[model samples]
Target chain A: MKTPLIDNLQYANFSPAIFEQMRAGGVDAVHVTIAYHETFREMVLNLERWNRWFEDHPDLIFKGTTAADVSLAQKTGRTAIFFGFQNPSPIEDDIGLVEICHQLGIRFMQLTYNNQSLLATGCYEDDDTGLTRMGRAVVTEMNRVGMVIDMSHSGERSTLEAIDHSTRPIAITHANPHWWHVALRNKSDAVLKALSGAGGMLGFSVYPHHLAGGSDCTLDSFCAMIAEAAARYGAEHLGIGTDLCQDQPDSIVEWMRVGRWTKGIDYGEGSASNAGFPPMPSWFNDNRDFGNIRTGLLNAGLEIAQVDGIMGGNWHRFYQQGFGPA
Target chain B: MKTPLIDNLQYANFSPAIFEQMRAGGVDAVHVTIAYHETFREMVLNLERWNRWFEDHPDLIFKGTTAADVSLAQKTGRTAIFFGFQNPSPIEDDIGLVEICHQLGIRFMQLTYNNQSLLATGCYEDDDTGLTRMGRAVVTEMNRVGMVIDMSHSGERSTLEAIDHSTRPIAITHANPHWWHVALRNKSDAVLKALSGAGGMLGFSVYPHHLAGGSDCTLDSFCAMIAEAAARYGAEHLGIGTDLCQDQPDSIVEWMRVGRWTKGIDYGEGSASNAGFPPMPSWFNDNRDFGNIRTGLLNAGLEIAQVDGIMGGNWHRFYQQGFGPA
Candidate 1:
């Protein structure tokens, strides 16, 4: 059996060193986001930089927007980099932009980051209106455009609505089930049911703040949480969206708190930052070098197929459906 | 039979002359949108203008955000102006912005204008993702913030999801059911059912492009269309959202076509424009001056109570549920 190792999601600040770390860790592929609240010019400029980097080191960075692309990259021993969006803000109010972004190779799109937008309500909103009229139209457009709708920061109503309205499977690219932790950021069983019932994927986030024990959460406890979700919503739809903000400065934390960059309500007051974990252990200080998750799963006696799906196969399948022919 | 006459929605580039016309025509109230894609500076400027205008003519302009406010305005014979939004783009990704705008007297909020945004998807998106994660959170926040969720330009997925996700009833502040006219801009019967089932309101738009006969549609035909919707969805949940873009410049049309203030794809080709109807015809052109819809309903022999609901009573109730007090 070809034991595949994939890191479905990570939000490390992009750098040459990070790329080198990913390559060194034998990481097969990762979804990289481009869209946020940045102006179109800024997004385009970032894309240009990414394109240059990929071109400069084809051995390290391979553009992948489909499951087949990831598989191909894995076979070639190159890390696949799937384009994604942390928010749909760049699309503005035009539904036509969905297709435009799809053409530009954005396979995964998180509806909102920390705040409310045109498509649906975000997690930080006091009241979740679910999906709006425009949000419904967006679901159809994403379906038509073959882009995977990721509801990591979405509100409950909007999340369920997307699940019902989507023609294909959706994904919670990074979220913890509320069962594991009762935070506004966590997904409820109803949400999990809706997502899985629609053949969608739920990428469990490894952020300590969202876990029940906060900073006290351990990798074993996190894996147990995943097992609980699997028991409830099936393992096929389970995956990982580590949501690792590695190499980000403390100023970035302040930016997120101010709702400037993250665009959400401040969660610092009551929530744990690093859960209870000590400042990033030496091996995982850089998310790119965090190879212990796979090993952790193996140590837990999970099957290779289950571990493979959790690591990357689920995300790979999701992308294949979103990006059309490999 | 006391047949009430009201304009459900209108976005007049307001002037003293327009206010004079509204008062002269015995118009009871108008839903005035304050939120567009304007920058914070522009929004503040517009608000200032409105504040000064209201202060200067308290007897003519009454601020409102709920059905009770409309009733109060009606009793006082003052034309109530309910603060509303055509798009939530001004709020951007900030969920707190909803409350800020709500405190500023904005009552109605459409998730998207004509395209994809962070909260919900627009009607024109090739694939409607319905509500984004943030969109859901926004809805919840809106509900908590006491702002009505409007789904005029929102896509199908977003609309249905919004209806399902909202703890309170939602509204399509301006729209036509697709069953009456198969335009992509209209809602389907299923969507209408979901919306109404959730105790939401459907404000039938009087735009010629959305009517069965397009530009050829007369006031009688427009009323007939409402009658059809009333027959199907019931008059209680059916109201008017005139969508009267009176006094708006041709440039606004051009902007709407490109999906943003700036240019991109032009989806407005062959689409109807208010140009031909400039000095708008009776009933819809200058909705305030047109008594034809009231006459048409009476001519059709509908009950005065039903007409009242269709005119503005239902919308008033919607606002009451969305925005407390006045």
Candidate 2:
């Protein structure tokens, strides 16, 4: 098989153009966030919209329900779109809906976004009470139904609880190590160690705020961080989840951060001076620029196998293992 | 609290008259088969129709999503209608739909109807292949999502495998012991032994074909059979599933057996001479006659507690244990 190229997470402004760019980048599969704060019915409506997209764009993209679909996309020269949720709002109070969303091809879901939820505490919360009663049950249900738990936006205590409680591996689909960049969203060495120790993959993020020097972060520096992660946690556990919010309107950031919970603006990552999507680094602007990272990793002293694994091979393997019943 | 009276399974041509009969019968809850061979989308339409029924008949009936709803219905003096499937066709080939149907309040789903399905072999299939690859996975998913695996219409080997594989107790939502009646649809002693031994429940079927004397089967004899079952298996494993098909048109029988799979008609339990639904036994012709069985059981020398367990308490307890994550 041609080394499969997969991006574990992205909440992109998806359109035919973005799909075409995925094809241009030789990307076989992309896990896309289909829900942030949408209710179950609203998430279903979003799925309906995606169903229409699949029907409309058969040659460009196909809905992927399993990791095997990655190879299918590679052979057919199309992109396999895997659905995910940035928050557990779609499931609401019902744990039964975890399987329903998984059935609808949602392969991943975060227990928390940026606050306390029925399941877990989020990163911004002052005290992380960890996984709630419902959260623990939902995790077992999700594991049984082959849905991966993503703790990217969850607090440390909650994330640790999830990694320990989940019988199957859980992921942090988009974030860097706090050791590299001291952002609240970035994970600690302890979390990453426990994650990889439990066989879970960590997809390094390319969001501007997650980078060391903001939007001015160099490709060499980013690749160097990857090499360090590989040295510490083993190369097989590393992958990419570019956190790309491309072509989105500034208003969407407000909806993403505030949803319907607050009346005032909550500028996430971006302050009042820059309250929207920060400019993406020139080196990796869109799906078509994925090759730049591969080249940068090769120049940053990574072996070809390690670089290939980080690019997509690792995720392809993870998808194969994670997208089915344990 | 009055002991909740719940029927484990029924498929009737429901109307306001039936609701009135349920009220008169004092039935607190009932597991109603919503799909025979319908696909997931088609099953959803059936649920929508049921939703309208709940809205239209609020005084007589309400939708039951949990065991607590049974008590709610008792307090409200209306029957709580619990959804189920007589066959796994609603989920088709996807293991994910087990949870989706559960989310829609479906409590029981049979592995097969009267022929081989993707998951398991039906009673009518000559060769029993047991659980298919998808069937094993679906069982775990069902176990996780709290959807009961029903083997009422499935073949012996497949039924045994399901009992073995499911960590949670499985159910035969509507079927009788073959020792009582030689109908192929009736389960064998081996199957019942395995079922009850594994903490599973066996809901006795009252359909004419599965009874010793067909439509003339007496309440005394039916209660005597229950007494025998209680001797063989614990009373905790027994409940009423009636298999009542009241007021259904003849065309529905054909649809239930054949669906869209074949153009020709299938007689199912009814032979060429007695096609369509056999006349219901006189002692239990409708929901209003449930009290007759209760009296008969009392007359048949069973304790009040055992009779109550056989009537509904067993299923009420099952609903409590079986409707949540293990």
lDDT of 2 by residue, B83-163 (tens): 889888878776655765675688888888989999999999899999999999888888876888999999999999999
Provide per-model DockQ scores: 0.01, 0.03
lDDT of 1 by residue, A1-326 (tens): 25445666676678878888877777777877675666543455556567657757877787776677767876888788877787887677767656556655788887877678888888878888888888888888788768888898888888898888888898888889887788888988999998999899988776666766655677777777776676788777888777677776765555444535445545442435432223443334554544577667766667777777787777666666667722
* Model 1 lDDT per residue over B1-326, tens place: 23334566787778887887778777777887775676533464566577657757877876665666666776777788877777876676666566556656787888987778888888877889888999999888788768888888888889899988888888887788787777877888888988887888988776666776776667776777777777777889987777777788776655445535565545442335333323343456664545677788777766888888887777766666778621
A126 Cα displacement, candidate 1 (Å):
49
Off by over 4 Å in 2: B1-326
Q: What interface RMSD do all candidates show, one decimal each?
A: 16.1, 8.2
* Candidates' chain B TM-scores in the order shown: 0.91, 0.98
Report fnat in order of the candidates.
0.00, 0.00
Compose the digit string of candidate 2's lDDT tens values, residues A1-326.
Answer: 87898898888888999988998888899999999999876676677677657758989999898988999999999999999999999888867567556656889999999889999999989999999999999999889879999999999999999999999998999999999999989999999999999999999999999999999999999999999999999999999999999999998888899999899888878899999899998798999988999999999899999999999999988988898966
- Give the CA lDDT, 0 to 100, for residue A151 in model 1: 91
Q: Looking at candidate 2, what is the lDDT of residue B68?
A: 92
Task: Indicate the TM-score of model 1.
Answer: 0.49
